[model samples]
Target: MTNRAGRTGTLNEELLRKAATLQEALPYLRRFAGEVFVIKYGGHAMGDDTLAKAFAENIVLLKQVGIHPVIVHGGGPQIGRMLERLKIHSQFVDGLRVTDRETVDIVEMVLSGSINKQIVSAIQLAGGMAIGLSGKDGALIQARKLTRSKADPDSNIERILDLGFVGEPRHINPDIFNAIDLDAVIPVIAPIGVGKNGETFNINADSAAGAIASALGAAKLIMLTDVAGVLDKDGQLLPVLTPRDVLVLRGEGVITGGMIPKIETCLDAVRNGVGAATILDGRVENVILLETFTEHGVGTMIRRDDPADGEGG
Candidate 1:
């Protein structure tokens, strides 16, 4: 009887603590209320059930608190799996997947339709109304073919090689986004765009999300990735960084390879009017809540201007 009572008392204490935390979050919530927030949802969260639920709950709570959350997800792994099953040999030029016509169709099928719907369904199951959409829907993201050079010099790979339907977003139609009744429904976006020629293309989710956020003048752009954030020379995460800091880190060889494009997306988002771009670790539990509603955020944040250390979370 005594042990049962103790357990009950502990539960009560935890409840009270949660209540206090929620109350404290009210001011932060008010500040972001009615503001658009674009989140690039990928990394481990896209696969893990627990992380997916946590992500869904975070977006739901953001809605409950009056912040409009727009989600753009990347299912590269899924797309790769689908491609493999089709026995299509995929070739990568540079870091980007060389998406030909057939590959583009596969990308659309797996990402825009299937994975996007799954995310929406999951969000809905978590008690949030979610609407799954694609860049082709109402032509939200208008893009053009992106050409790049290959690496095989003997084949004259330096010459501009067309990657077929692969594209980078050139414009965003915010009207499609605004039309969604975000008071209850969350927007789940898949990164696939259509060109003026009525051709469908595969777009990088980071690029799409940044473009969308810039169009919306989103108060925050949160990119959920595998790593914690940009690291310094000592291999420590840079909690805060500016565009100059990014260049500095790059010069020091701390930021290289894949991190470059992601950071570039952040920089572009900020430059294009999004307030801030935060690169967060999707593996961590409740990271979104900690970043948005609490004082100390858990990952790297790229802003136009760095906040004073120990200030302005």
Candidate 2:
């Protein structure tokens, strides 16, 4: 009889803790109601079946609670795997894939055809209406070729490298989002754009999500990465940062390699009027919920300025 009583007590404690968590989330749910959250979902999280299902359920929960979510997903690993299977050689310049004409076709196939629909199907199976789209659909993102200059180590001279079919967003047309019923549908976007000459260009998913968030004036732009947000020199998460803080970190070299571009995307999105931008570890189960609904978020959040104007956590 004592063992049975103890088991019931433990179960009651767990139930109370769960209820407490929901109560804590109520304020955030009310605060962000009717706001838009643009999520850049990628990394290993998308490949894991359990994580993918949790992500879909989170999106559905957000919608059911009256917050709209727009997803921009990356497929670098998937694209590389496909290219390898096809025996196509590829290279990267400054971390941007140097996509040739043929390579761009494969990128499009993987991103728009397989990956996009996969996410949509996951969300639909989780009991949400999800529509998959590419930047070429409805002229969503107008892009221009991205050009990079590399410094020659010997002569200290900069030389331009042409990354064929690799493009950056020049403009974002958000009218396509209006056609969807935000109350019932989520949009899963593939980062393939159309150039001025009607050529298909492969866009970086982070950049595309930032541009879309800015154009939509979203309340938040959340980037799901593999790492635990931006780390300090001591390797601790910074939690909150301003654009100036990001620039200082970059200058100090604390932020390097691929992280620089991700930070730049967050800075750009916040400065361009997205309320705030976050970089969080997508590996955590229900990471989006923990970041959005809790008092202490799980990653670095970059804001345009100080949170003195009744915004930001």
> Best candidate, lDDT-wise?
2
Candidate 1 per-residue C-alpha lDDT over 1-313 given as tens digits, one digit per residue, 9 for 90 to 100: 4799889999999999999988877778878889889999998889999999889988888888899999999999999889999999898876678888788989999997889988998888888999999999999999999878656757755567777788999899888866878777799999999899889989999999999999999989999999988878787888888888888888888899999999999999888888888999999988889988876667998888645322344
Provide the lDDT at 57 for model 2.
97
lDDT of 1 at 310: 20
lDDT of 2 at 106: 100
Where does the lowest 10-residue lDDT sum fall in candidate 1? 304-313
Show pairs that collide, candidate 2: none
Model 2 regions more than 4 Å off: 1-4, 309-313
lDDT of 2 by residue, 1-313 (tens): 4799889999999999999999988999998999999999999899999999999999999998999999999999999999999999999887889999999999999999999999999999999999999999999999999999999999989999999999999999978988878777899999999998899999999999999999999999999999999999899999988878887888998999889899989888887888999999999999999999988878898887666622543
